[model samples]
Target: MRGSGQIVNRRRMIAGAGAAVLGTLLPGGAGAGRATDNALLPKLTDGRHWRIGYAETMPYGNYAGTLASIVKGLDALSWLNGAARMPYDAGQTDSQALWRWLSAHDLGPRIRFVADGWYGGLDQAPAEPILQRLESGGDIDLMIVMGTIAGRKLAVDRHSVPTLVFSTTNAVAAGIVAAAEQSGRDHVWAHVDPQRYYRQLRIFHETFGFRRLGIAYENSPAGRAIASIADIEAMAGQLGYELVARHVQAPAGPDDQERYYADLAAAWSDLAQRVDAMYITFGRWSLDRFPALVRVFQERGIPTFSQLGPEEVAQGALMSVARGDFDGIGQFGASVIARLANGERLADMRQIYFDTPTIAWNLAVASRMGYRPAMSALLAADNIYTSLRAVP
Candidate 1:
C-alpha cells in the first residue's frame, strides 16, 4: 500500500517537433561530475541552475515508493553536490501546480523543473508549453524519462535540447539508439544486463525445480527491459522448463482487478498440467497484484518466484532477485542530467544503475503452499519476512 505522504507528479506532450523546439528553448544544459567530486569544485563544466524534466511511468506497481526515494536523493544531491536548482514543488502533482508553487518560491538559479509526464492525462503535458517556456525563458537542460512512456520512438535533435533516456530496458532494443554503447548524440539508455534476469531464474530453479514458468508482463518497454523472458529464453531452455509468458494489458477498470486475479489463476490453473510451479513477473500489473497471486499460488499448490526487488519481498513476494535501489537510480539520474545541464556533449558517457539483489522469504507463504524446500534451504533462508497469513 502507498503511504499517506507518498506524492506524485506528471505532465503531457502533443506534437513531437513542437516539443523539440520547446525543449531547445529551455536550458537543456547543465554541469555534473562524478559522485566523488567535491561539492565546491566543478569537475566537468561549470553550469549554474539545472533545467530538468522527469518522466516516470508505471507508478502504480510497487513503484510509488521508488519515486519518493528519488525525491529524497535529488534533494541530497542538491545540497552535497553544489548542484543546480531543480524545477517544481516538492510534492505537487502537476506542472501547473508546480509552476504555481515555483512562482512565489525561492528555489534560486540552482533549480529548474519541467514536470513529471506520468501523472497527467494523455496529451495533456503539451510540449509547446515547455518549448515556449524555453523560448520565452526556459532553463531546463535535460529531461530524465523512466521507461519509454513516450510511446513512439524519439531521436536526438541536436538543434533542440537533448534528452537523456533512463528507460529501464536496454535502449538498443527499443531502437532508441544504434547500440548500447551509443544512443543518439543526446540520448543513451542505461544498460541492464540480460544476464541479471538469468541469475534470478537460476535462483528460482534452486527453489522450484524449474517446472513450467508462468510469467506476466505489461506491454511497456520499461517492464520488458527488466526481463523480456524472450531475450533470455535460453535461461529457461537451460533449466528445461516450459515457458508460458502472458502479455497482460492494463486492467480496464477497478473491477478488472478481479479479472487480473482470474487471469493469473488461469495462467497457472490451465497450465498446471504442464507446469508444477510458476514464476510471476515483476511487470507493473503482476507486481502490483502480488498478494492476490500469492493467494492463488497457495490455492493451486504451486510455488511462486519473483525477482523484482526488496519492497516486494516485504509484501510477501516469494523472492525478488534483481538490484533496484531508487536512491541509487535517482542519484545516477541527477548526476547525469546535471552533467547534461552543464553542456556536456552526452557522447559515450557510461550507463549506470545500482544492482544489489536482496532476498526476502515469506515463511508462512512457503508453509501454506506446501513449499517445504530442503531443510538446508530453510535454514539458509535470509530475512524470513512474515505475512498476515504466515504461520505464527
Candidate 2:
C-alpha cells in the first residue's frame, strides 16, 4: 500500500505542477514552439509591456486573499518584485486599500498596474463603462476579475480582452464559464473546483452525523450560486439528511449591508430552532458580526461549519476544510497568467484546478458545543484554533 506521504506527493504533482504539465497539453505550449526566454516575464504579443486591470463583485475577503496569492506567485516567478508585498490583509474586506497598494507598489518593468482601472461592486458600479474599458483592449492587456457578478459581466463574447476570473464560489454554476474543461470564450479563463462545496458538506455530515442541516442564502440567481444550494441538496439526497434553508435579502447598497445582516440574524435565529447543525454560507456581512451571528448556534449547542474558510472558523464557526495555504492556488493562477501573457490561447488552457483540502478545527468552539473530536481527527487538522478571535 502507498503511504499517506506518497498520496499527498502524487496529488501535488498532479495539481501544483501547473505550467509545465499544462503547457504540454494545450496549444502554443512548449511543444508548439512557444517562446520561453521571456515567458516568466509579462509582455504583450506586440512587444509592449503588459498593463493589468481589476474588477470585483464587491469588497470581499476571498477576493483580497486570491489577489494577494496571485501577486505573491508572480513575485516568486520573477514576474514582479519578489521583495514587495501587498499592503492590505487578505482577511479584510477593503478593496480601496488594495488599489492604493497596487497604485504605489513598483510591480517591475514587465507589467504596469493601470491606476485608474480598478473597480469594485459590479452591482453598484455601472457595467457599461467597465465593459467599454475591457473592450478597448489597448487600455489594458488583461483584466483580473474577481467574484461571480463581475465574471459574468466581463467574461462574455462582447468583450474580447483576456479576462481571468477567481474567488467565486462555483464559477460553472454561476454561468461564468461553460464547464470545468473549457471556458467557452476565447478571451476568458476561470479557476474552478466544482465539487468544493460537496466535499465540505460531506465532511461536515460524516463528522457530526446531523439529521437535519440548515443553510442561509440570498434568493436570487447569484445568491444560489454563492450558497451552492444544488450541491447541498444533492448531498442531502445521498447522505440521508434533511436540508433546512432560509433566504435573507441581499444588500441593495452599502448602506443596506447592516439590514442584510439583521435579516440573516433573524433567519439563523429561526433556523437554530429547527436544525441539528448549521452551514454558514457566504455573504458580504462584515466579519465583525461573526461572533454574534454564531452566538445563537452556540447557545443551542449546534455545530456550525463555515463555507468561506478557516478565517470564519477563527472568528466563531466550529470547523471547515481549507487549503493549508494559498500558495498552491496562487501558483496555479500565476502560471495561467504568465502563459497567457506569453501568447498562449486562453481557450486551449484547462480551467479545472482543485486545492488539496485540510481540516481546520477550533477546539474552543467544539468544547462549547460539548463535542470532543477523535484523536485521529485532531491529529489530521492543518489549523487548530485554541480560542476565537476578538470581534473586529
Candidate 3:
C-alpha cells in the first residue's frame, strides 16, 4: 500500500499489483499491461497545460463531499506534478483546502476550469449545453462527469475526449460501462462505489437483528440508478429480512422542495409503523430533504442508516457506510487522469472503484433508539459521533 501523503505509482500499481485486488472485488480484470514502470508525473502536451472540464447533475445538492474529493484529487495531482507546496489545514473541507492551495500557489494560470454545468434536475438544464461546451472548444483534454445520470448520458454519447465518471453508483446498471473491468467506449472510464445498502443491511441485521428495514428513495434517474427497489428486494431476500420501501417522486423545482418533504414525512410515518429500522439511500431529492427526513426518523425512534457520506453520519444518522474519501478518491482519479494526459490509452487504464469505504456511527442516535452495536462493529467504524450536534 502507498504511504500517507505519498503519490501512488500508477504505472506499476495498475499494471498488475492493483489488478490482483481489483480482479476479486470487481467483475472482470484482464488485458492490462504488466510492466512495473516508475513514471508518476502526468505528461501534458507541450506548450498547453492539461484542461479538465467538469459537469455535475446537481452541483448544489449534497455534492459537497464529492466536490471536496475532486479538489483533493486535483491538489494531489498538482503536488505530484511539481507544483509549489501550500499550507495544509485539516479543519477545512477538501474544496476549501484546494482553493487555499490554489490561491497560495497562484496556479490559476496553469489549470483551466471549463463547462462547469449543473443539470439542476432531469429537465431543468438539459445536457445539450454541456455537450456544446465540450464540442465548441475542442481544447478540453479531459472531462469529469459528477453524477450517475449525467455520467450515463455522457458515456453513451459520442465524444473523443478521455472522460472520467466520478461518484456514480452502479455504473454498469446505469449503462456507464459494459462491466467493471471494461469500458464499452474506449474514451470513457468510471469510478463507481458499490451500493452501501447491501453491506449496511447486513451489518444492521448482525448488529440489531432487525427483520424489517425501511428505505426512502427518489424516483429520478439518479435516484433509481443509485439504489433500486429491485436490488433492495433481492438483498433483503438473501439476508432473510423484509423491506418496506417508500418511493418519493423527484422534485420538479424549488416550489416542490417543501412538498417533497411533506410526502417523505408521510412515508416515514408509514414506514415507522411497519419497519424496525430505516436505511436512507442517496438521491438528490432525498438528500436535499435529509434534515427533515432524519428528524422524522428520530421522532419515531427509528434507528436509521444512511449511505451518503461522513457528513451525514456526523449530522445524526445512527450509522452509515460513508463513501466519500475525497483526498483518496481525488488522488486515485488524478493519477489516472494524469496517466491519460501522458498519452496512456483509456483501454489500458482500468476502471476502478473507491474500495476504502468509511464506517460511521452516531452514538447519540444509537442510544436514543436503545441499540448497542457489537464491540467489533464499534471498533471497525472509521468515524463516530457522540452527540446530535453537528460537527463542523
**Judged by TM-score, which candidate is best?**
2
Runs in model 2 lying further than 4 Å from the true structure? 1-46, 83-99, 123-125, 389-392
Displacement of residue 249 (Cα, Å) in model 1 is 4.9
Provide TM-scores for the models: 0.66, 0.83, 0.76
Write the number of the candidate with greater TM-score, choosing between 1 and 3.
3
Q: Is candidate 2 or candidate 3 better by lDDT?
A: 2
User: Candidate 2 at residue 48, lDDT?
Assistant: 62
Root-mean-square deviation (CA) per prediction: 11.9, 7.6, 7.4
Residue runs of model 1 more than 4 Å from their true location after superposition: 1-34, 38-48, 60-108, 115-140, 148-160, 167-170, 217-227, 246-265, 282-290, 310-316, 322-325, 373-384, 388-392
lDDT sort, best first: 2, 3, 1
RMSD of 1: 11.9
What are the clash counts of all predictions, listed in order? 33, 0, 2
Q: Residue 227, candidate 1: how far off, in angstroms?
A: 4.9
lDDT of 3 at 156: 52
**lDDT score at residue 154, model 3, on the 0-100 scale:** 70
**What lDDT is reached at residue 163 by model 3?**
76
Candidate with maximal lDDT: 2
